[model samples]
Target: MKTFFQELKNRRVYRVAITYVIAGSATVQVVGTVLPIFHAPDWVQQVFVALVAFGFPVALVLAWCFDLEDGAIKMTCGDGRAVVTSRRVWILAGVGLLVAGSALTGYWLWHPWKRLSDAASMSSDTLSAPPVIEKSIAVLPFENLSDDKQNAYFADGVQDEILTDLAKVADLKVISRTSVMQYKTSAQRNLREIAKALGVAHILEGTVQRAGGRIRVSAQLIDARTDMHLWAERYDRDLADVFGIESELAQQIVSQLKSKLSAREKAAIEQKPTADLAAHDLYIRAKTLIASSALSTPQAESLLEAVHLLNQAVERDPAFARAYYQLAEAHDLLYLQGIDHTPARLAMADGAIQSLARLRPNSGEAHLAFAKHFYWCYHDYDRAREELTLAQKSLPNDPLPFQLAGYIDRRQGRWPESIKNLERAIELDPQNSAFLEQIARSYECLRRYVDAERALDRAIALVPKDAAMRARRAEIELHWHADARPLMSTIQAIIAKDSREGKNIAELWLYGLLCERDFDGALRALAALPIDGCHQETILFPRVWCGGIVARMRGDTASARAAFTSARNELAKLVREQPAYAEALCALGMADAALGHKEDAIREGRRAAELLPVAKDAIVGPLLVQNLALIYAWTGEKDLALEQLSIAAKLPGYLSYGQLRLHPYWDPLRGDPRFEKVVASLAPK
Candidate 1:
């Protein structure tokens, strides 16, 4: 051992080892800092470190056998012995080089990252290529070939039925009906572009004709990538055999795509939704109305008509589980949108859910109905999620389950999860503006104003003239930079385009005017509203309340008191009818505070907070708390007001920098150090 140590020192092997270690360490440190900037894969750094390590032994072997003399290579003459150039020494040097080379080659061949990259490249042509989804399709709306134009709904029904059947197969990625309906009237029939937009590889187009108790259906499936026909069929069957033809067509598409169909999926596809054709027609009509309506007065009327049709359909065939599911959804929407937020509306939804459960308890539609019921009516998020899990397993291609999960996540204060689920829904329903709107709301709650605006921009692109989305996009400026001019300009543009559109966004226009401290404009906007009132989500504020707010802001004490008195009277009736209505109660509490009814104001505000706490609903619950803080400020309880305001500032809600800086609602808390601290906390960081 002593001779080996002396030999290593004489050959300067220790010097080479030390230099290599220092250089390798510096190289690793530099590479570690530099590689991430270029977005290199993690394994690149690992492989680099391994290569440097392999060179260390080879460096020491070369140092032992050779020397650099007068800047030239020479054999090492250890202990003055004649330049030890032996066969064993050369063999050892070669072995060291061979070992290092073998290590480098083995790592390149056997590393997990290498295998992963190779497999990925084999699976796809390019590194950045999207995975090729083989069994994916979109079913376009069937053309109405009937002599009677009203039979378009019948054609739509047949297409929807076939699409629904295809959706049941777990092996296929079927585009949702909402996405495919856009191509119903597409004259050019650009199959490739349509399929790309829908994220599918195959397209199915068909036509349905009904003539004198007989139906003729023609369907053709084409590979969108190649624009080549893969399958085509024409069926002339009696009206009674329409369901059979739809089932057969779905089976043929599955077979052509070579998708694995479990026995359960096959049985589900074969089962008929309804035995009565008349009832089925009514159900289809109801579904169409629900799909086409928005959240406006027209939407309320449309939903009501749908409910009537669904009721008639169920009456015709009590076992129509699909009709019952649609009925439940329509009723839930009516109640949720505040068109008829009465208990009777919720009870109607409950009745439909009960009937659906009795007929098909384990069906995806039934689970979805129950999930909506729990979410909208009870605010029971946990139960809704439990139902959603089951619905997702059965309805893998449907976007509703993921959309509802996003809603539940938002209510639970899981903003990241909410955004993720909403994005997943967009993947399944790329054209759904509702999903974009919801994701925008989630981003807004998290104070990601830029992301929120981008989401709203996408929604506005999908629906160009949507005043609501445009208004929302403009509102992000106020939250981000405490500027309201952009929102005011957008509202003016919308109102200028059409007075009806202005009426639709009347509440938003008033809000913008108030933010700008244009009391006269606010009052004028309020006066132009319908005599009943303007709605803010679930709350219907009376015009008197709006006038009272303007009067208070303008310091017209007598007018403010009188307006509040009348507004209080009207809101009292509303609170009496719907005692559990949190938004209406909050509005009434503000009215009471404006009128100096301090005790009543505080009581109503506390009741509203108790009805919807932040734990139960993170989105609206903080707004209720903020309203209570306002009540405290109005009642001369500055300490309590500051405390509640501080709490609201830290929670997720609609409180924005513009509102805190400019709105008169927080006037009483002005000049207080604690209130200023709370406002500064909410300012964009």
Candidate 2:
């Protein structure tokens, strides 16, 4: 035993053992700390630690057999007689231990059965069970296998038709097209991950190939949880029979899922949208464009192209109810967004709705169209509500009815109901930033700044380049704590990225600058604004009006008068062209007030308020009244201004703490106790 101990010391085995343990410990610590930076799985760190531990016995064996002498590694010297049995025994034991540890560690880390058991255990736990709805499914974008890639729209149309048919079945929870479209061109589709994200147990994937008036569609339904194919089929048919193929596929999926389908749902699914294939193709393209555009800030050129396509579609098939509905919606958005706020635009929307009503008087599409018409064109919340109720009953899975209901509820000051309806919309269309923005708007109106910011944060995450949403997110800080730094920083960042894109949010940038009393920055922003002006909801401010405000802020009376006069003339012409445009009248009233036309300003402001009263439109109505307050302030009507300001402050509107505290428009009544009290009421707790 003494000789064995001396041999171990002479070989420097103690040093090797201590060094190995220290190195192993350090390696484990380094791996544990570094792996998480890359978001490595928890099991990765555990496996790494096990690997380091498994090396312990191997290090001991090597240390026992070898010696580090001077600068060279050499085998330990032994007497010429025979190798010691005890040393041999100890080395063998170390080698055996190393092999055993390695084998066990590898098995523990990589065993398939163990992984399966763990997964099963997790699935069985009710507290941590995956949210997988048995009857829920997401239809991924069908691959376009046509030679002409431009026919991608045709493939999309096929997929959309199938999805629409499936959505009609009330028993199945079909993920909306907007949400599933993200996975359309994904190079790697993780079935389980996608299913979890979409909260569905089933996933449907397909391919569409079209050539020379013939089409082939292959669809497969998979149990995403188990990666098992439930059903699959391939259809080869003429282009004219595509609708039948979609209907048959929908029926098969419904049967496979064991979903109950009502008679009406079956009929609706089987009903062809258009008899003409060309018309169907056009309708599909138009609908695709509409889906890509945002509801709050729609692309005007895309909408115009969609209108042209839908018109051609309707002309090809006079009784295409869906095409007419799309047409009405396109025109309604055009009018609502002020892209083409003309009577002629409303007339076109009305014509489309009339045609739709004639074709499908009691259809969900008809009710939705009428609801949008009432809400967007007439601001008739009551009529829109009635239509929305009918639409909801017929379109159980549709998100539009709920989204519109939320909008109406917001306008009617039903904040909680609006939030509930918007949340419902989000559940059906999870990827829709527009719904998120609408919910954020309700939170903002209610002065729930944190909730509003959270909603906008989610919206911004969905669309990182959405300048309007980012601007709104920054504006929340201003509204909450009278802070303009965040708004200015966000705007500057956006502008620095692309100055041309700044025009999209020029109004917000100007607002931030004005809030900080940065007159020069406000002037620059106004100069960059579009000549036709910018819009905030229903109100349209001519660029000249913004210029006038900037000049007034700088105390340049001459420039202010000239800019206001120009704005007044332009707005007066617009009012003449659009006599009932309350937004235009409001701008004109402000311009008159700036030019010192006191009576004329007051009369125009009153008329504009009367045209769109709060009773009629709780959303835009308060904006007009707020503008009236500004008009009174400019005209030296202090008491009247304070009274109107008080009323506007109490209502749900764009009124913010930053605006009330910082904007110069209310300078006339700034020192008054009533005006100060109104501003105080808006301060964040």
RMSD of each: 11.0, 15.8
Give the per-residue lDDT of model 2 (tens digit) for 81-180: 3355655647645764776577556755665344434433322331122356799888999999999998888889888988888887888888888878
Compose the digit string of candidate 1's lDDT tens values, residues 122-219.
22321121344989999999999999998988899999999999998889988888878877888889999888877789999999999989999999
Say which candidate scores most in lDDT: 1
Worst 10 residues of 2 by lDDT: 121-130
In model 2, the runs with Cα more than 4 Å from the true position are 1-132, 295-298, 554-559, 577-579
Overall local distance difference test of candidate 2: 0.83
TM-score of 2: 0.78
